[model samples]
Each structure stands twice: as structure tokens, then as C-alpha cells.
Target: MNGDWLLRGRDGRLSVYLPSGDAVLCRAELGPGGPWEASPRKVGGDQKLRPGPAVGQGADGYAHLVSWRPTKPGEAGLVHSTHFRPRLAALDWVPIGHPDKSGDRTGAPAVAVDGEGRAHVFVRNKGGGLSMVAQKEKGGWEPWRDLKGSDVQEDLAAVTGESGRVELYAAVPGGLLYWRQGEPGKPPVLEEAVETPVRPGTLRALATSADRTTLFYTDDSGDLCAWRPGGKPVALLASAGPGPVSAVRCELDGHDCTLLAQRSSSGRVAFAAYPTEQEAAGAWWAESGPQLPSDARVSLATDEDGRVVAATLSPSTGQLLLTRRKDEPGLALEAWREG
Candidate 1:
């Protein structure tokens, strides 16, 4: 299924997670509606799965993963593949394998699940070292450890009320780290990850506020911060320039959506709309027009309530997009894009 976020959950339910083994537990479920009238439920299939990218879900519903597999797949080639032997997973809908035994080779693996549900995995080890592993209440998974702290760069958050705390935001080109998790084998209280500095700006994506006490993020020269510790991470709207973001969502009602498609830095493809918990008295920062299609970088699209669209991934040239505010528009398109 070669998935990359294809999310949809507000009940109309939709999900896609298949990066094709090496470890990619493609789980699908399209029941209530949407994503084509629904009819997909792979339920969770990972023979031993080993694809590493990034995945998370907490508040205790459980579902965590980090995909990365290129020992051979389209020639991203990794013959020794960082030396193999790093497969950490803790699934939901059902799947959890933790006896701990990884050696990470930096293929991008960043996972999260804390505030007491356990499971907090990180990686950047091809011998370079940044490795980490947690998950100990159910007992098991705590071996590949080695995070001497200095230059770590992980990302995971869902601090919903902080029961055991789930927040692992790391940055270390210059420095920033905060691995706070209140209850999980007694260790996770580092601090120094509250970004915004060093120019070209880059906090990129972070969202949690269905009562997670406000924590919305987005920054990479486009500005959009908003935090919860002593207050000060708010910029909200075109602060620098350059485009092609297309991904930063957290709205089943938690509100906070960001999607951009190339053309700035001087070219011109500016689309704006920001507001993810910052409206108690004057909430007014609206934007939802028509922007995206000038060298689209994955044709920005969103659904589940952030409904917006623009697609064309390969139609002569392709530049996709999709957003249906109930007008019921989908499939049956000859152009305006989708291939």
C-alpha cells in the first residue's frame, strides 16, 4: 500500500499504513464513510515488519511505529543496511513486540508513547549513536539504550493531561531537547527543547489540543507556533517565505491544519490559514481560498474537517489537491488534478 499519512479519523474512519515490510504494518479501516464510501480494513498486518519513518498514538489508544526499510526497495540501497537488527514495534488494534534488541543504523526511526503507557523509541544509530528505547511496565524493551543527551533530534508529543506525560521533542543542530514523560521506568526528564531561533526557522509540525493543554507547532520559515510553558511560541502566518510544506494536521476537532505547496522563496504559491488553539477572545486569522498548483510538491490535501484539496500527481505533469466540504466531490475528475 506504500502509505504516507493517508489519514481520516473523526469517525468516518480511514487509515493507511503500508510502506511494504522491512516492517510496514499496513492497517486499514474505512467503515463509516469517506476515502471512497469506505471498505478497507487490513486491520494490522506486519509479518515481522521493518520499515522506519515515524508513527505515534497516545492518550492510551495505543498504536506506535517508525518505518524504514531499504536494504533493497527501489535502489535507496543499503547493502549492509546500517548493519540491520533494529525492529522496535508496539502496535495497536493489536501488536506489541518488545524484548529489546536493536542496533539502529540511522534510517530515520522516531516513535512515541509516554505519560505512562510506556514505549518511547528513538534512533539515529549507524554507529553515530542516538539510540533509545523504553517500555517497561508490561516489562521488556530497554536495551539498545545510549542517548548521552547532546544533539539528539527526536519528535513525539501527545501530552494530553500528562498522566505519564508523552512529549519527546528534540532538536540538536544548535540544541533543544525535552523528553518529558512522567511515569515509565523512572527516567525521561530532560529539558531544552523549546525551539525558534537560528533563522530559516524550523519547528515544522506538532499538534495536541483536544484538551492536551494547547501545543500547536509549525515553523520552517512560515511561522506558526503556540506552546504551554511560560507562554511564548506564537507567530502564526508567513514570517519568512518559501513553500512546499503540505503536511501538518491535527483536526478531528483539536484544530490546527497546515498544508502548503511550493512556489515561494520568491516564486509564488502562498496559501494561508492558521489557528490551532489561540482563540479564546479574538480568534480571527482566517484563510481558505485557492492556492496550490505552481509546481505542487505532493498537491496539498486534507480531510476530516480541514477539508481542502488540490491534486495531480502525474497527469502530463501532475499537481494534485482534494477537499470536499460536503459538496461530495471526489473521483470522476478528468483534470484540476489527480493521477
Candidate 2:
């Protein structure tokens, strides 16, 4: 492996990863003229403010991000165990000020493009709760508006469909959010929340098919659940192991839907995959995966035609051990044998 990654844009240009190494923050340019990754522009304000989550460009093209600026003053006196309580505001991140104000970006961040070629960036307000900012027409940005919420996560999706039928999906602690615009240049008609036991922050991964016919997300139990509305969320599996499972990658393979998961431990890396389909209900899934390594592992992505591409993190050296399934040969085109 050359150890290089390029976000292929509609223009076929490649922007090298900033400062090299693994990127903690990244976004796809999406659409023509291609994707671009640059250093985070300094949002002048409090020195105590910390970067919350990186902005993610929608698979369609809009970028999303959020930073935390405190309003309370002084360093964080609370501990991680108490993070859920009080909902501490160490800093106040005001994205749009009086043009004379100062602060950082705040709350959970989300990004989506409207039918009118505008980028909608959302952030939670510490004061008003769910506050967001929109970048109207690829220009600077719009004033902060109150988006309803007590807290939020960074995972979101958008679609610019026919006749200005633009839709946005956000992962909230309550459940999935749907924002749609039937007209032009206006806020979407917010829908009521759908009830679910799992919280948004507890979500492991979320993905939607190109047609929006299939939408899925993983829970703390490691079971990949999905529903296209009017349908039930069927559980995919019981999870590869216990605790927080991450580095997930999945795709719809020919009649079968596939998922790849990693389990990181002491010094050896391990990986596994799960397969399910509409025709499969009583069919087994855990039986589909192979015995993994001894230490840590993480998935990269999947290829078209339903095959998965994953990189297992080398436990001792942290080398990304890559693997994928093939058609004809031995171990399903995804077996790795260290010689």
C-alpha cells in the first residue's frame, strides 16, 4: 500500500491530506469542481474553547462543523463522569456575531445543501438549546437561528431531489430528524420526532442508500438496524464483541447487505463482517465472519458490488493491515495471511 488517500472529486483532482498522517477531521467535496480539505480557519474568540467535532461535507457536497466556546468563564472544573449532568458550557461559540463580536463555534454540527444551492450548517445553542447557522449561496454565512434540541451529534445526511424537494437528516439524542423544503429559500418544515429507545449519541453508525429506500444505523448492542419508514427496524446481529464498537463499514452487495466491524484489544488486531438481506430473517449472521486477530482493528470503507475494504490496525506497530474479498480465489477475496 502506498499509504496515500485522495478524495476523488467530479473534477478528478486530488488534494493531499493536510500535514499528512491519519486525518482526525475530513469532509468530501461532493459533486463537480471536486472536494477540498484545508486548515480550519481560526474563529477568533475565547482561548478556553476547544474543537468539538470536525465538519463533514455531505456525501452530496455541503460541509458541516462545530466548535465549543464557553460563556461561564475559567477552565472546566467538572469531570468526564459528570459530563451528562449540568451540561457544562465552558465557552460560548457564536458563529455569527454583531460583526463586532468574538467567540468560537458551538454545539453539535450538521451540514446539508438546499435546492437553492445553499449550505445549511447546524449547531446546538447552549442558551437556546438547538441553534444552527446556514451558509446562504456558498457565500459567508447566515445569522444563528434557534434549532430545537437539548443536545445533538455530528452525523447527518441530505438529499437535493427533484422539484426542490430537499431533505435533511440529523441524529439527535431523541431520534432521527427530517427537515424538508417544498418551496425555495426557506426553513424546512420540521417534523415531529419518531420514538426510539436508543439515543442519538449512542448510535454507532448511520447510512442511507442512494435512493433513500434503505436507511440504517447501529446501536450500542452492535446490532445493525434499519427501516425505510413504514417498516420495522430489523436487527442485523448481536455485535462482534462487547463495549463500544466502531470503525464500521458497510454496503449493499447483490441481494445481500454486508457490514464489517473491528475489535481492538491489547496487542493483536481483529476484524469481522455481517451479512443480511430482506429475504433473510431467521438466517444466521455471526456465522458469516472469520476468527480475527488478537488485538485491535478498524474498518476503512467498502467498494461497489457489495465488497468491503478494511484496514486492520496493527496492535504493536499500528500498521493498517488491509483486506478485501475477491470473487474466484480462496478466502472470499478478503483473507489475510501474514507470511
Candidate 3:
């Protein structure tokens, strides 16, 4: 139930991936307003995985996924799989191994595809720092390399800017750690860290403009905040609940906007929309549909027509629930549909 679970493929069809029991399952949309497949497709074969697999789609329209696979007590590793085309089954999960050969504990992983269609995976390493592996020019993976930082928490955030350069962020004790590529396809360099009180597991990133990304997270008091590089954090909504918020930039009423969905403390899905990067203007949160499990994660993505598609698991039945933004205006949503 990671924030990256829902994605739109190149063909304009939407796909939702979630951990069902011990295996991951995928249900795809037939088309806009079309029904989802009756049966969920099993991804990565019979491999068992930790819940909340991270998924990212490249410019080529392929969906790439990474998840934690528990091995021995200290030998757990991350595995990766890809759907090369829309509505097609994904390849089997391949073990990417741990960053430390000495069997250090690994935290959750985050994946992002660069401008050149290479997928980059980042995770908290053994020493509470960050390590990464990226797809090589010819489709092979480069060895895991350390992208130094310390006291890092789980819930790492990674995003590829409109310029194709990939940037990463992690919550630390007193502030946040940052990294970015000098240019597309280049390795990321550690940038100046921002001093702010970011709640662990609530960090999320969205590219609001070309070459720039805005970070969203709940502050120490559980209030939502937004910040961009070289700028002070801007406080947004209050009581955004716990965990991360799913965000996507799309056009609303002919105006560019950013849509966010989060499971409120009341266990209901709430949504908010505002002009992209205009947080100071203000935003209002509206509860949507039915109540989900307090711990259930929500995801947001845009369909081919730029309509916001939202997904979450049913609290009672554990079924995949999906809804989309109505074409009329604002953040109005269609009825909740089960997959």
C-alpha cells in the first residue's frame, strides 16, 4: 500500500498494484470509465513480499516495481519487476540483493525512472544512510552505490524532474537530507540539507514544474507542509493524519493544479486541490467516498485524459477500490468502484 501503487500506462489505461496476502496483485483498467479486469493478475510469481511495494512508470510507458523480500533474519533484500507494455503481465521479480554484503538491515525502497528510461532504486542502508542502484545504458543494473547521509528514516522520496534529473529526499532527526543529479543520467550528489521538522513516513515528492519538485509532509504537529529547494517550508493543511500523502499534478477547470489524497485520522479518504506550487493561496480538504482502514494507504494518478484516478483497499473485504475525478470541475469524484 505504498503511495506509488497506482499508475497510468502509456496506452492510457490505469493499473493498481497492491500486496494481497503474501503476493502482489495487479488490476488494470480496460480504458477510461471501463471496468477493471474481473480477476487480479499475480505479479512476480510465487515470491513473498513485504507490503507496500514502490512502483514508477518511465517515459516509455513501462511500469517498474520494487519490493522487499524477507530472507534470513539479516539477509532480506529488495526485488524488482517490470511491465514492458500496457495491460500485459509483468516479468518475474528479480532479486536486487542488499546494499551491504555484510547483511545490514534495509528499510523500504523507492524507485524513479530518469529521462533516459532508466529506473533508479533508493533505500535506507545499514548505517541509516542511503544507497541506490540504477539501470545502465544497455539495460543492465549498476552495482549498489552509497549516496551518503545519516540518521535517515524509512519512507524515502524520489522523483524525476521535468528536466529528467532525478532527486531524492529522506527524513532525518532534526531536518531533511537531499540529493540530486547535476544532469540527467549522472549520479546524484548530496546537496545542502534543509532544517525542518518532518514527520517520519509522511514524506512525499511531486514535480510541480520543469526542473523543480515540491516536497509535502506532515510537520511535527501533524500539519501538512510544502517546500521546494532553496525555500523555507510553507505550511498547508492541518491534521493531514499520519503516513504519506499521494499527490499528482493535473489540469482542473483549465487551470494547472495539484491533487492530493490521504487517509484521514478518521479512516476516511480525504482530498485537496490547489494551484500547483501555490500553497500560500490555501486548500480545503473534503472527505471522499467511504471510510477505509485507518492504516490503509491511498494513491493518486492521472489517466490519459488527465483525470485524477484514486485507489485504495477496502477496509472490510481487502478488495481494491478505485474512483476517478469527474470531468465537470473541481475535485468531484465518480462512485467508488471495486476491482
lDDT of each: 0.40, 0.39, 0.83
Candidate 3 has an lDDT of: 0.83
lDDT by residue (1-339, candidate 2, tens digit) is 111122222233222111112112222223222222233212222334343333332344222333343445532210010011111121223343311133333334444445554655544444424444565665666765665644445554444443444455556664665555647666655554554434343233323343333334556455655544445567655444432233323443443443434352333333444443351544232222334455433434443343454444433343334455566432254454320
Model 2, which residues run further than 4 Å from truth? 1-49, 58-106, 113-118, 127-129, 149-177, 181-186, 204-223, 230-232, 241-253, 256-307, 312-321, 327-339
The C-alpha local distance difference test score for the whole of candidate 1 amounts to 0.40
Q: Write the per-residue lDDT of candidate 3 for residues 244-322, one digit (tens) a residue.
A: 8999988988899998888888888888989999997899889987777765778888888778888887534667788
lDDT, candidate 1, 1-339, per-residue tens: 111234444343434333432444333333423333222223234333444345554544444554443333432311101101112122322322221232323445555556565656665444443556666676655555665465444332323234545555444554345555455565455644565542221323343343244443455455544455445566545432332233344232344533333334443333443444443322222233344444333333354444554332222232333333344332212223121
The true-versus-predicted C-alpha distance at residue 264 of model 3, in Å, is: 1.6
Pick the winner on TM-score between candidates 1 and 2.
2
**TM-score of model 1 (CA atoms):** 0.28
Between candidates 1 and 2, the lDDT winner: 1
TM-score of every model versus the real structure: 0.28, 0.54, 0.94
Count of backbone collisions within predicted model 1: 34
Looking at candidate 3, the ten consecutive residues that score lowest on lDDT are 313-322
Error of 2 at 303 (Å): 5.5
